[model samples]
Target: MSSTPSTVLDRFLRYVQIDTQSDPNSTAQPSTEKQKDLSRLLVTELFEMGVLDAHLDEHGYVYATLPANTTKYNVPVICFCSHVDTSPDCSGAGVKPIVHTKWDGSDIVLPDDLSQVLRQSEHPDLTAQIGNDIVTASGATLLGADNKAGVAEIMDAVYFLINNPDIKHGTIKILFTPDEEIGRGTAKVDLEKLGAAFGYTIDGESVGTLEDETFSADAVKITISGVSTHPGFAKGKLENALKIAADVLATLPKDTLSPETTEDMEGFIHPTNIEGILEKVTLGFIIRDFTVAGLHEKETYLKRILENVLTNYPHSTAHFEVIEQYRNMKEVLDQHPQVSDYALEAIRRSGLTAKRRSIRGGTDGSRLSFMGLPCPNIFAGEHAFHSKLEWVSVQDMQKAVEVIVNLCQIWEEKA
Candidate 1:
């Protein structure tokens, strides 16, 4: 193995330049063809790094394995996973990454757009990265640091391990999935082929966060059908579906049970989309909570609101449908507490105070846990994800690489 440190920053810069934005409207597995561009590049880079088995599958998922260098035979195969596609909410094309060398704890205004500023007050994490190199986009596009930072950290860790065979570790699997932002990240994962005992999704924010739990989620779609009549003669005969939908939205508790009002373990009922006319209207909502009971309660409350709103428009008919998205990984991770315990130990070994936290949003790990791999989330330094104001610190990312290296050692030592 080479004694020199891996160039994780360079890898990350190169990855964000590629436009790998995922599309939610697309029915394809990857949701976008451009996602394959990064997937193919990852495969090529993996092969160049001496992982001969590294290849992108038909579904644009990149899978690679690092064979164990140790004499011990019982070490469990641990998988480090991340997604390649950026969120569909923001543009990820022609990303010009700006590096702020030695951040002085000041507001960073994007070069392309001064309106897009990274304020220290808004981002408390910036306080910790005072002297570190901060990376952000040029404001025209999103910096794909969400999972790309995770990908770079994992790649650098693998490269470090490969170059230094002295660091004894068991077989490690690397998985780069697609469409994580659109929520189909692990939909096509072949667990039989992965064959790992446990997994860690290096896809969280900040420096030392080790998230073992995520919100249990469900999608609610409300469709309203109303009688349409000519406006000239529509005094009492017309029941505007748009008016009913508006009333329902206005009745939703804005002071509580909302994404803007909730924090920590609090649940939220968020309306994602609303569209329709006087004849028909549809409302899309995403419900989140830490518990199944909480989810049901929120759904019941939402239905009650809709029912009350429809009472005014007796001629209108409404249909409310709930779709299951994903459950909290805590249900699975609780059964295997060692998965997070080892990660916390690894974080301390990497010289950071490990913070055991839960994600307000779900990761690919959430779905993978239910799929039988039992995965938890690890920090990759991504901050303000899914926006033009996104940023990450080079020092924080390097620390994450150290955490990954330490995790490999911890699992082997414990085994």
Candidate 2:
């Protein structure tokens, strides 16, 4: 089964036009109401395409089951999932996508400011994309290609599967999740309802990149308290919490730390927020490492620094809390090598070489894998994610749809 670039581009544009940026602070399911705008459309489209079971759950997860035509083989139920939400880091609203009809391997301008060009000098990958129609934002907002492309591809694949029943497939499940950007996409996923032995999330970048490994992550919250006094008499009586907070912040090693300073297998302590003043202060940090032992070592290093500070400043107290966010999915995926191997062969059959890549950030697949699904991530052919400069080749986007269809066919062949 195959789809043209135009079909995939039209679907992708329609999805990106909807405002579905997730709110991390929201207390509701789906995180933001606007996310449903896309979910409802997806549900409507699925039903129109003859997927009777397609419907949105109470929490806004859209699930549809395409029942197998041939039950003799007892094929394994497989799932293809993607999130509908874009990152809260940028505006996903009012996206004006500009398609370069045929990119000439040069810099392209976004909609808001023509002066702000997505320079080829900065992105050498664009050189490989010459003569391809690239979809990009107008500089006013992010293109929402992060997972919108994923959603579009999933939709395209579903249509392809329906139109071509002779292709042979097992029971295929499709899920469009919300709030993946805020790290809660899998929170409401009913695993039993999904009924897939293993799954693939169409949420990665490039044509061949497969991510089955991710960092072990945790968040640390630190609060400091001190006695506030009048400036004139404060020299001896006051213990400035702001100063102590600065001291503690300075204690984190400056030599090799933070996301900007590290890459690949390296780990870092990223300081995300700080607030309050002289008498009280609060801080938040995200710790990430590829291995559990390394993550634990980083935690020990952080605890040691705080203990030293508390010993030096007895009157000024501090409260520290560490919460584990997600673990390395490798532990779970390693137990089921067939999941990764199957996905690899599927990509190979699509005429693209598959390369395994370790994701610096975790995915919903990480949580799902640990939850006993043994899920891995497949590429959606997007790049420069979570930014206004983000873009994706229309050719690549359609190829992703082909890959999904091929995966289903490959699974059936093996069965």
Candidate 3:
């Protein structure tokens, strides 16, 4: 039993109206208290869907269990996951979702300071969306489709399954994580307790897109220390940290080389932020690569770049720290081919073609896979994520619910 677009849209709009922007600078587990608002709502919805055990943990993770009803199907329990936090890039508060009925596929201008033309020429997919309602944000705020669409789809699928018990399925677990945008969504995830042999995260972009691979990412923070003296009396004896920081930046391959210049399988070092003075400076960068070997190569190259810069300016003490955020899930998922096969078959059963793709960034699934749960990402029909131009197709979202239902059926059949 698939959910109707009208119903999914209503749920999505209600979820986005809550402000759950995660904080990157915060040391808290969930990062923001407002995230609890959505988590609590999800808990209530799950209980209403007949998942009587639905509850939110102390860390704001909402979980529920639909115990196995079919004795013939003894497949290991499966789970569906999505994050409740929106990016801190914009305000997620007071979000006003605008629903456009029968999209003409023209450029949509929002009341905020953004204009996005779904140029029919640019997106052929927009063609399929003609006569379908699309939900977007007024240029002032991000539409929260990034993961809310995922959340809505998960909720809808659970409710649909609850209403239709004839569908053969095993135990199903549902979870809504918080602070995923900040990269710590799964840090405290109780994997042993989750009890899912494999799961799917409904957070991909395109209708057919299924991402099982992603870049192994790391964040580097470089601190350059130098002797500072009065600029008015400065001479060759004075060493400026700001100048050293500039030299280190210059050592990088090229300033223009970025995500725009890079393509598939191309690794690049992105300088995200920098701030400091003549005495000390701190520069931040994110290094991304599809393979760990390539990641190591890039890391070594960066260290060499810094050493080369240090050679140019003697006596400058440069200290750097790099922390790995997430690893590529491909290698792990590759070993478990069933995970991908189940997802592909599920999408196909939903009447949508399955297209295996790569994630430009990471998802909570990546971390979950590494944590003994082979989790691949499923699409939720949301596009232009994390911006005011974000939009989701009503029909595709309904299809996502079907896909989720199909996934459980496929799993039981295989088992």
Candidate 4:
């Protein structure tokens, strides 16, 4: 709240200790009730900083507003967003964050688990954090810096704007969402109540990077029902569902169109889950691409593979289903060039060279863009997220705060 460098780090430290891991198998809006533990605390902290409108909704969303300090009436309302929940890929419980103050740039061995190590060779991003304070979690859990660093930076920027009223800016909005890790971040957000013309999600990685494009995504499920018979009399009478499903998976292309083999602009269809018995089996997959046509092409290709595999199991019947996920945000951002231009200018004003790039994964902004808010992503300096080796730099977080503060002023100036 004092605009000090420690404010962001302190906030980050406080946030990462909370166990806010979201469950992908849950049916609730947030996918986890523990997510509210962090949301409630955020609201209280915002209220302490003079944000009277700060409140947490029933769906575990935290929303707050900072009134305009400028005389200009044309400044568009801008919102800064981040997610509260950490990924389900790793454990986030009982997190112990350790800050390496003025780090000398060496491999960090997590205290909880001797085997867990953060090496500069594996993560090239550490090469840039030579003299900055680096934060990481104990060996057993993730640090939760994926988006909490963004949350802290936004909080610090809001506090700076509040204390320095002379630095004029337009009305600003703050939104903290839950379940972004499970793809439900924007599922229950009230856009009309938010009422922001343009927005930015402080959820990117690296320093001085802005992302306007993201992968268009979809989920596919294939269920197979096979004829079953007792093992003793199962010579030709038994068509095992598990074996049928395995055949389909094995038939998929192993050298191409996968998460491990794709990079940059390449698309991937990833098999995420498979569960079954002798009579029935369900296979789950996620398809990602930069375009709608690409998504369809991959989906069709996957189905073709499934169909060909089913030819060997005549008695087995299968059902294929596809679920629509968020699309590429660039399709919407292209209509509002000023949204990114102002952000780039703000980053430059903060004394950093801005690099406009595209993310291989989707963010909360991807859906919010189509929801009538042209939101892009800003860097929060998080690396190796959703793992025990997840880390964030204090200097990088402070720079994010400066970028956010500058963005407010830039929007007011351009108005």
Q: Using Cα atoms with residue i matched to residue i, what is each candidate's TM-score against the true structure? A: 0.96, 0.96, 0.95, 0.95
lDDT tens digits by residue: candidate 4, 58-121: 9999999999989999999999999999999999999999999999978899999989999999
For model 3, how does the per-residue alpha-carbon lDDT over 2-92 read when each residue is reduced to its tens digit?
3332357779999999999999999987899999999998888777767899989988898888887778646989999999999998878
Off by over 4 Å in 4: 1-6, 230-237
- Alpha-carbon lDDT of model 1: 0.93
- Show pairs that collide, candidate 2: 111-138
lDDT (tens digit, per residue) of candidate 1 on 170-208: 999999999999888988988899889999999989799
Candidate 3 structure lDDT: 0.86
RMSD of each: 1.7, 1.6, 2.0, 2.0
> What is the descending lDDT order?
1, 4, 2, 3
Lowest summed-lDDT stretch of 10 residues in model 2? 1-10
Candidate 4, poorest ten consecutive residues by summed lDDT? 1-10
- Return whichever of 1 and 3 wins on lDDT: 1
Candidate 4 structure lDDT: 0.92
Count of backbone clashes, every candidate in sequence: 2, 1, 2, 0
Write the residue-wise lDDT of candidate 2 on 1-415 in tens digits.
5332236788999999999999999999989988999999999989998999998988989999998876556788889999999999988888999899888876787759776589888876687789999999999889999999999999988888888878889999998899999999999999998899989999998778789999999988888897799989987678888888888889888778678889999999888899999889998889999998888888778878877976767788888888999999999999988888988887887888889999999999999998978889999988899888899999888778888888888788888
